[model samples]
Target chain A: MIGVELRLMLRRRRVWLCWVLLCALPTLVAILLATTRLAPPPGRGGAFLSAVVSNGQIFPAAALALVIPIFLPITVAIVAGDTVAGEASAGTLRYLLVRPVGRVRLLWAKLISVAAFVLLAVLFVTLVSYVVGVLAFGFGPDASIGGAGAIPSLSGVELTPLDVVGRTAATVGYLALCMLALGAVGLFFSTLTDSPLAATLGVLAFVVASAALQPLDAAAAIEPYLPTSHWLAWIDLYRDPILWTNLREGVLVQLGYVVIAFGAAWANFSTKDVTT
Target chain B: MIVATSGLTKRFGRVTAVDGVSLQVQEGVRFGLLGPNGSGKTTLVRMLLGLVHATSGSIEVLGEPMPRRARTVLPRVGALVEGPAAWDHLSGRANLRLLDAAGPGRARHRRRRVDAVLEQVGLGGVDRRPVKAYSLGMRQRLGIAAALLREPELLLLDEPTNGLDPRGIQEMRALLTSLNEAGTTVVLSSHLLTEVEALCTHVGVMDRGRLALSSELGALRTPTGRVLVRSPEPDAVVGLLDGQVVDRRGDTLTVRGAEPAALNARLVSGGVRVTGLTEERRTLEQVVLELTGTGNDRVDRRPREAVVPGRSRGAGGPR
Candidate 1:
């Protein structure tokens, strides 16, 4: 089942198009930063902007952070949303089920494929950005800088190349893990409806609502647990003597959500009528 | 028995799609599910395949309980439900290859199996063409190819010839006949009575979620047809004939059971004018129409059931 999904997803021309666009965005942005003397206005991705202009090597890290809250998650949600609903809508879910595959196994295959897609998407964007950053700008020590408050809670921190490398890996891993939970939400919604677009948009709507509510104190009590709230916790990984607090919390929270959300999906799908 | 369902029921809210449908399909028999639209034909097939859970009762497939044991049983059964469905972007062969990969069994020799099915379905030459380019008939054939991949012991097809042209329909009929002859129990749901007559050895007739009749073809079909006579005094002729006259038109009469030669002689001796005399056998289509009280076109509402004669072959088979 996983093999079938992989073949179906990877062979689609649009998937490749998405990859090109995702990878190209950061590279183009990095090139623009390296060539221009203009600095982004303060307090709005400014620190990451300054870091990108200072050293090409920091481009990958900056790009990954820039897209973490929105672009990467949206892409992941689209693929994940389409996994089950697309098949159902196309009237293929009936055939797939009649393959006699256990419902849980089918759901697991879908989850794994979405997770694979998320991993590749993030890696592609980060890898291409790193290469572009190195080509456009010179590689060397990156600024002890990132988006504002990336490490504001901590001080007296310094990093060598190896430290930066290690922290960056941790950050990427954190981002990937968080995205998996997001993908699970998408999958959950996929089981509820036969329209992939509707499922994806439903996940996006939740993300948007979470982001919309973040600034308001009224929603704060539940805000911390929202996927949007933990989405950027990887920023803490960049701090030397890396702050493990929110990163660990974020991991636990995301993993918890994955379990509950995926459990609900499996419960609903296992006995679903499969009318399509 | 390959399949035996007792009191199987499925209710979609207020509408009971399948109601206490107790049916059976024998091993190595060509069984056809005959019903009018919305009479639970598709729903019954879906339940048998475990696509739709039964609301009550039990279904056993190949000696293994259905749905509960569907996972194990399905791997040994092939099905084409509600016409053909395939990935439009993939070539016909690619689509089959993907399904074959997902089906139970070793991947080895699957390539040869695909080739054989494609050839069998007359799609060997066009297997490379993307499914989006296929005509409806071609796609239907592809669906059949997918079902045949595992060489399953049972084949379930619902309206398999819905989109096929005359030639394609004939090919499908021939394919199904050959498959049954080779000992694969075949179950198909269709309104094409002729197709069922030509292909099935046994039939289960349903109406409004109830089985009106299920029996061997030979049992349902009478031994002889009636003598149709055209006469100006048709109603008068009804009185003259001692045997029962089944139907009457403005100038014609259909007399059943009585030999045509005897009826003609009686009519001539009775001084009745007979313009035309011909023997017309009762067709499977005629039987279904009379049973369901429906003509050719499908009707959404389940017509009231007709009390058809003949007992169903034992919950399994005549044997």
Candidate 2:
């Protein structure tokens, strides 16, 4: 049933085109980042891509975070938002449901499809960013110890290229999990609303609102727990001795969200009348 | 019986969509569910297919409880509900192929069945065209093709004639008849009385979430011997024989309590001629309308009503 669902979803022009964009967008951005080298003013090259510096962790992370609220979430939103509503609106849902496939199988198939799209989008962004970042700045690991900090030269790290790539891939995997949570939340919203715009915007609003609160001094107490706050925990990958606490908490929160979102979506979708 | 529902009931909040309706579809029976709009026909079909949960009562398809084990039963059933709603972006063939893959099958069997059903439904020519480009009638045919792909033991069709041209309806009727002859039980819903009259062996009429009438079509035919008379001189005939004019539809006359033989005898005797006289065979449409209580608007008022030339209102009036 899932195989059929996946095949049907992939056949849609919107889904397929979005997937192509997901694969290409990051690569295009990477090319721009690498080729359009805007040198930092004076001694600013020493500063890592942090939030405060013109070209640092903050710049790239903010860009990536912005992409999260927009770019990456669209893939999640398209797949998730289309899951039930698309079927209902098209009338194919009745046909599919009348087949041997159970509601559970249908929901799982959609969840898996959304999960696959999330992974594809994240990998696209990571590969393009890594290749472009390395090409522009050199193929070495840079360190941004904290927010607004300097990105140390890669010449000092003792790790082999293999170790660095392996660590970077692992970090990418963690980030993918965070994005997967967004996909699940988007799916939950899709089940609640029949309009794709509503579902997509609903998920984006949640992510953007959380990100908006992170920098506020008064919301400092809740900032650490926000999906947006932990979104950049991947920066810990550059730390000489990576701290697993933030990564662990991020993974836990993401997992919790995925479980809850997916559970809600499943529960709502299974019992949904699907009148459309 | 292939499918049976006992006291099936479904309610949405305060409104009941299907209210304690019992239905039985026997093996190889071509059952027609007839009703006006909002008569709960679709809701009942949904319940039988386990798409909508019944609020109260039992439903068994092929002797198994519905919904609880609907997956097991679904493999043996096929349905085309409302219309053929497919992924408009996909080619018509791809849509059929995708639906075909939902059931258990091998690659070759799936392809063969898809091709066979497409051909059967007369969509063989437009297999590669995007579904969005197909006409409404063609889309309905494609939906039937998708439904018939598996050759299931039971088939459920909802408004299958809708959007179909006359030729398409005839083809569909013949196709369903043959499928039933080959041992597949079918449950179809349609507002088109002609389609049901020409195809179904049994009919069920529903009104306001309740079954108003259910029986063999043969039983609904008005009793024989009552002749339908159409004459411009209805007054002369009425005055000569004092025959009760049951109803007047344009120049036609429905005279009850009178035999054609007696009416003919009295007309000749009184020198009042009748232009046309034919035996009235009640159409399924008339029976359905009257059974559903939507025929009350039909004015049967005429002073020359009740009483016939040869037969009185007492014993064997017409038949």
Candidate 3:
């Protein structure tokens, strides 16, 4: 059943369109940065945009920063929100249920498929930006004090290229988890309504509301619990000593959301009458 | 019994879709569930397939408790509820392949089974066009093909012939009849009276969420205790039968209280030429209409009393 679900997701043109559009944004940003050679001031623009002008190897991290705020979440919400409600509106949910596919089993397959999309989208953005970054700005000169072929960390400490690769990989994993937390929320909303558009909007509203409240002093008490609050914590991986404080808190918070949201989804779906 | 439901009922908030429908369907019989629009036929079919949970009752299919053992029982029972539905972007064949793979079926014979069912449903010559491009009749056939993918022991179809043309309807009737002949119990819900009368062996009529009548097709069409006689000399036959003649139309006379054979002998002995004589049996239309009430779709306003200036009380008026 998982295999079938994956096949169905892979065959959709809309999924591929999402991947193309996601890659397009960062590539466009890389071109403008390459041709014009104007980098956002340090500590002002995206997490690593200013650094990418000197070392293209860090562009993948910069690209992650570019999309993490908006592009990635929108695509994830669209896919995850469409999971069950899309099937219900298309009139296939009842057929699948009667096909002897247990409701719990179906939900499991859908979640796994949504997880796969998140991993692939993050990986594709990381990979495509790496190639674009290298072509637009060749590898930086070996000028760092740490060693030859090393890049500078956000903490003013020099790091080797191999270390850069390892940090980027960690960043990818962290961002994927964060997006999955959002996906789980989307899944819960998907089970609540039969319109895929409605569920997708519901997830978007949730993210926008969370992001909106994160900055207010009055909301500071609940800020730590918001799902979007920890999304940028992956940038901590680039620190010289690797700030584990926010990263650890981020993992726990995202894991909590996944569990609670998926639990709610299952509770509502298992007993659904499937009138459609 | 292939299917038995006791006090099966389902309510959607304030609306009672199915009300205490204790239906029984025997094996190897083509059971036609006759009803009007909004008569709860689709809801009942959905419950039988375990798609809709009963509000308070029990359902048993293939002698196993439904929804509880649905994983085991459902594979042996195929169903098509409401109208046909498939992924609009995928071809009919692709849709079938995906649906077949979702259930517990032999992976080795997946392609073979899909092809065979498509052929059985008369889509053998279909091309690779997406389902969105297929005609309504083609989609209907594809829906049936999906149901037949497992060679189920019992087939439950709701409005199975819904979008088919005249010839397509004929072909479907033939296919269902052949499948039933091979020992598969067939149950179909339809609003078309002629469709049921032509295809079904047993009948159950539903009205306003209640099962009004259920019996063998033959039992419901019992003789009406009258014999119809057609002769060249209609007056001679009427004169010979005297007061037994209940109705006269052209060259035929409806005579009560006599069998065809006895009536024929009497007419011939009385020097009357009897061209045709046969006992009258009730038509299915008459039987269904008699058992059921006005269809739920109809809404009539309250009748108003007549106001006349000079007419006294007890005067005749439209009731």
Report the number of clashing residue pairs per model: 0, 10, 0
lDDT of each: 0.81, 0.75, 0.91
Instruction: Show model 3 residue runs off by greater than 4 Å.
Output: A143-148, B235-258, B301-319
Worst 10 residues of 3 chain B by lDDT: B299-308
Individual DockQ of the candidates?
0.62, 0.54, 0.65
Please list the residue runs of candidate 2 whose C-alpha ends up more than 4 Å from where it truly belongs after superposition: A19-36, A40-66, A129-159, A216-224, B105-108, B229-254, B261-277, B293-319
Ten-residue stretch with the least lDDT total in model 1 chain A: A147-156
Chain B vs. true chain B: TM-score per candidate: 0.80, 0.82, 0.92
Q: For candidate 2, lDDT tens digit of each residue in B1-319? A: 8888888888989988788888887787899999887788888888877788888999999889998878788888888887779888888888888887776666677777878898898877674778889899999998888778778899999998889888998899889999999999889998788888889999999887888887888988966546788787877766765647777787677887788878778777887767898878878877887777543235575656655578566675443
Over the stretch A1-276, how does candidate 1's per-residue lDDT look in tens digits?
Answer: 888878888987767776787887787777677677565753476235555554566677778876777777778778888888998888778888887667888899899888888788888877888788767765544334542122221243544556666776776777788889989999999999999999999999978987899878988898778777887677677665677888888999999988988999999998888777
Model 3 lDDT tens row, B116-199: 999999999888999999999999999999989899999999999999999999999999999999998999999999999999
- Candidate topping lDDT: 3
Flag regions of model 1 displaced more than 4 Å. A141-158, B223-225, B229-257, B264-279, B293-319
Rank by DockQ (best first): 3, 1, 2
User: Better model by DockQ, 1 or 3?
Assistant: 3
Report the C-alpha lDDT of model 3 over A1-276, residue by residue, as the tens digit.
898899999989999999999999999999999999999999998889999988888889999999999999999999999999999999988888888788888998999999999999999999999989877876777655543356789998988888988999998899999999999999999999999999999999999999999999999999999999999999889999999999999999999999999999999998888888
- Least accurate 10 contiguous residues by lDDT in model 2 chain B: B293-302
Binned by DockQ into CAPRI classes (incorrect, acceptable, medium, high), candidate 1 is medium
lDDT over C-alpha atoms for residue A41 of model 3: 93
